[model samples]
Target: MKDAHSNRVLLLSLLIGFIVVSLFVLGVRTLVPPDEGRYAEMAREMFASGDWITTRLNGIKYFEKPPLQTWMNALSFTLFGVGDWQARLWTGLCGIIGVLLTGYAGARVYGPRVGLYAALVLGSSFYWVACSQINSLDMGLSGMMTIALCALLVAQRDSATPTEQRNWMLLCWAGMALAVLSKGLIGLVLPGGVLVFYTLAARDWQIWTRLHLGKGLLLFFAIAAPWFVLVGLQNPEQPHFFFIHEHFDRFLLKEHKREAAWWIFLALLAAGCVPWLGVLVQSLLQSLRRTPGAAQERFRPGLLLLVWVVFIIAFFTKSSSKLPGYILPVFPAVALMIAHYLETASRRSRSVNAALLVLLGAAFLGFVPFMLRLAKRAGEDLLYQQYQPWVLAAGIVALAGGVLALVFDRRLQRDRAVIALALGGFFATHLILAGFEPIGQARAGVGMVPAIRAEIMPTSTIYAVGLYEQSLTFYLGRPVVLVDYLDEFSFGLQQQPALAIPTVDAFVVQWRAHAAAGVRDIAITRDDIVAQLKKDGVPVRIVAADARRIVIANF
Candidate 1:
């Protein structure tokens, strides 16, 4: 019966993990608010044009990012159809794998309870939840990093056994190779930081011999170097800007011109871990208070987790450019640390449950005013009308969950119940937030692109004046010629008969000259010489008009 009960608990934990992870995977969608659409469209354009070497947005050379992510999306499109969901599926699946691997690592180091909690925390994290649902490189990069970290831990744990150590070390190198493919040098940088720090602190120089550094280096180069060499050979001009400027200069100096103070990232990390912030803080404090012996035994894992989090924060803080998803690879370690805390607390104190309940209650209350503001901003009066009932429902769930946790604090079964309740509150709050207003706002601007495309001729030269919408370019499936009011925005504009005018007067002069030279059936913004032409008896047809500008095709 004891064995049977143990098996049942394991099955139940696995089942819960599956359900939670599935909720995260299935609930999130492709073409999320910002970067996903841009990346997906770039890949679509690349696949459509059959250009594997250089990434082109609307048929012009775009070298802002490497082609690896675009290549992944293109492959997905080839296997599946070229749609939002198919493009985002790669990231979503990677996120799921990351959650599982995190759980596996936790189970090995701590126990099944820790494993389950780690997966739960990660699956529910706002950052992971948001990033996984999009078509971006971060999810894949995070997965690769998590795999590498887990392999390193396994190798460290098995250092006394040479054969097991060798196997684990091989996995670590393999993971590092994949991580490089996912992002860049930071793959090696982050893991390398953790390993070095661990070795120095624990005074474990013997472990270095077990790592087989020569073999590992050769393997890493063998897997990750060829692609860089091939892609570089394919595009000779890529080296100076891509390698030195983008990778190094961006990090070391503020060349990209995106410097932020260190504390800003600390605030971002706190925000990214939302709802779990209180528990994570407690965990960090607890880890800090450990003695040297305890530190040596568990210090490597904790230090590794800390290093992963700190290095990313420091790296990005010092970088000339920054984005929210850049810090995502650190989330796995954060989740692991939080999971360990929760498991330890559950074993030792009932006060932990009390604290979690309080956090959930606060989170529930916090959403009410936030949702109202979001609804007002999005102009969704109907959501405001329906808001009270949803708020009440969420509050009820939170209260019920809190009461249940308080009532059954001593029961092991109640632990899962409390988790379910917390999950319910989180899901309910986000479901309302996601479904009601924010999504509508994100789609509002691009919603008219399809209509504009339909109104214009298939081969009609469309141009964006002083505006760039990558999503628009991707959906239009044709290069929207950019009339450059600026030179910086010229990279993504297609090669066509267009003038990159620096000023409105220059554009007006050029348009008149082109028209006089018998360039008939030209498309121009209504303000860009079309108005003057209309005054001069030049026939103009309004192709499409939006809140911002008008598209006029004239003869």
Candidate 2:
């Protein structure tokens, strides 16, 4: 009993350490482009406008995705005040919850050791760490969907009482509703679809009787329906565009312009699992084996996890739209499976795995020269130069982790060995991220913020010409009038045409008019726009310039 209590106290300490590490890493770097900038600015706009239901970007009605994340971001802004880490608070919390839930659920279903190991594995995972620290919609979606999936697994397990099962299933339904709010239909579809496939594949037709669909549907609708109905009613174009264009067309066609081959997700998984790849594969194989009993009588979490992973991969592989983050939902399942395997692995097997991890880390160091050469070719040599030391440190740390794991295994302290490896992987992930901060700094246009902020006035109009560095608006604390550029904001601009200047010529005219009216306005553009304005004989003063863009004023 004393030993058990000591172990619990140690686990609690480790969990708290993980959360503190997550919080520290969250604020280590500036927000990165396109996704981070856009999402943060949307939240900023929502906070400024006090419009929680309608999501907008740069003062235009933006609806590329659902507003749940934006709403969370807005709320975060309200609570914490707007900043880089503040912007990432919600996603990071969701990620932390995901790690805790996976650990707790695994412990509940398997045993205490499996649960703790699962949380550690997931908390240290490369892709999961990176995504969780950024302001992306996918992490929030992944976290909520994980809850729904894990809740259902626990609720329907053989050991659950009828009351326990019903409560857990209701939590599953609530999670599904939040998932839908997170991204869209996939939250509910993916889990529900996986359950259907599992039922059919396992021939467990009686499992449907346990779903409690009537009340579950009510719970799902109660949570998910209000937002859809309100948004659709407020904007008539929402239902058609969101359901049809964003959902169906994105999946069925290449209109969104994001595409990758079917095998991309597989490659991602291989890269993502990195240090634990060999053991994860073995665990997956073990999961496929059934207990010695009637199929319906058995509750197979491994089989459920396997189906979940395969179905998500297959589903996205079939979609025309693909991104690396789409497959994040599978990582938690894989983590639990790997954790279970590691719980029972022999010391010999554990030692071998530790050695493999050491080799992988050492191998990472050898690629640094090639990566630097490629960066030089791409004109990012300075960025790569700063990045090398951080990468080297990460590699060394990982190697040390493996060495420590082996030492622990030799002492028959297997749990300590696993913890060493997990900690190594966790720190390695952050070191790599810290290395990439220089790159993000350059690419995210943060250096230009001070110059843009300097020339600000109440009546000043800002124009983004030919290109939009999404983070610029957030830093400048005001929306820029876009000139001759329409990308993701195109939908929002269509709803309110007055918000955008349709052409460079039109922008020049506006600039001249604003100048005539004694108004100072700035245009953020690329070098080509500068040349075009010079050739057109328009008066311009260069306020600031960076490698990627320039800020010019018409005076």
lDDT of each: 0.64, 0.86
> Could you give candidate 2's per-residue lDDT for residues 72-178 as a string of tens digits?
99998999898899889889998999999998888888878788888888888888887899889989999998899789888978899999889999999999999
Superposed model 1: Cα runs more than 4 Å off: 1-34, 159-161, 288-299, 346-414, 425-433, 436-444, 485-555
TM-score of 1: 0.82
Tens-place lDDT per residue, model 1, 62-143, is 5656566788888878887687666776777777888888877877766677777777678767677666766777888888
Q: Which candidate gets the maximum lDDT versus the true structure?
A: 2
Candidate 1 clash pair list: none
